[model samples]
Target: MPKAVLALGANQGDPARQLALAGAAIAAHPDIEVLAESSVIVTPPWGKTDQAEFHNAALLIETGLSPLDLLDFCLATEAGIGRVRLEKWGPRVIDIDLIAYDRLEMESERLTLPHPYAHQRDFVLTPLREIAPDIADWLVNRIGTSSA
Candidate 1:
């Protein structure tokens, strides 16, 4: 099974509730077994800061599902929670993003893993480091080892 991390967020209509509900839904999926979860954190909107504050959490999952299939599941889960894709980084009922999948890098029109901004965004790195401290350390440790 491939281990994957998903970043969940919501900012409209009971943001926290929406996030929790989506987490449950993702866990219930047949191929997805949620291994760990992070506490919800409230963050000022990132790209679109004008929108409502976001409630964010990260999920660690073990799954047999492929990347595209996992993305489909995420999309379906978002829609199930009344998520509206109105604007990029805008208000949403629930937003589920496949942040990483066992160090896999995938880029396509629909999704990107190890999300493009994963390294740059504190909101993402903080929770990831908290949940997978070893992986976090390995990443940072690699920076200088390349020249060693």
Candidate 2:
């Protein structure tokens, strides 16, 4: 099974509960194994900053699903949690980002491996560093230094 890293966040509704629901959904997936999860942290909004602070966390998983399949699963999970896409970087009930997939790197219409912005966001890096320091280091080395 390939190991992947996921970054999770939510600012609207019950942020903590939203994160917990996402974790539960991921754990329930037959094709995925939850290897590790980081403690949730409150973070100031990134990108569009006018929204409420977000609760962020990270997950390390071993999965049988391909990258695109995992991305699709994440999208489905967000929708299931009441995410509505109304604006770019808008507040949401849940946001599940496929931050990394093994060591694979690729860009498609639907997904990108080793997420394009993983190294730049503390909300993504801090929680990620807690659960998977090796991956966090790899991401910084591969990309650039993080502002965190």
Which residue pairs does candidate 1 place in steric collision?
none
1-148 per-residue lDDT for model 2 (tens digits): 9999989999998999999999999999999999999999999999999989999999999999999999999999999999999999889999999999998988888887778888889999999989999999999888775323
Model 2: which residue pairs collide?
none
Summing lDDT over every window of 10 consecutive residues in candidate 1, give the lowest-scoring window. 139-148
- Model 1: residues with Cα > 4 Å off, grouped in runs: 136-148
Cα error, candidate 1, residue 114 (Å)? 1.8
Name the best candidate (by lDDT).
Answer: 2
> 1-148, model 1: which lDDT tens digit per residue?
9998888988889988898899899888889999888888888889888877888888888999999899999999999899879889888999888877887766799877656665555666667677876545543444224322
Alpha-carbon local distance difference test for all models: 0.80, 0.93
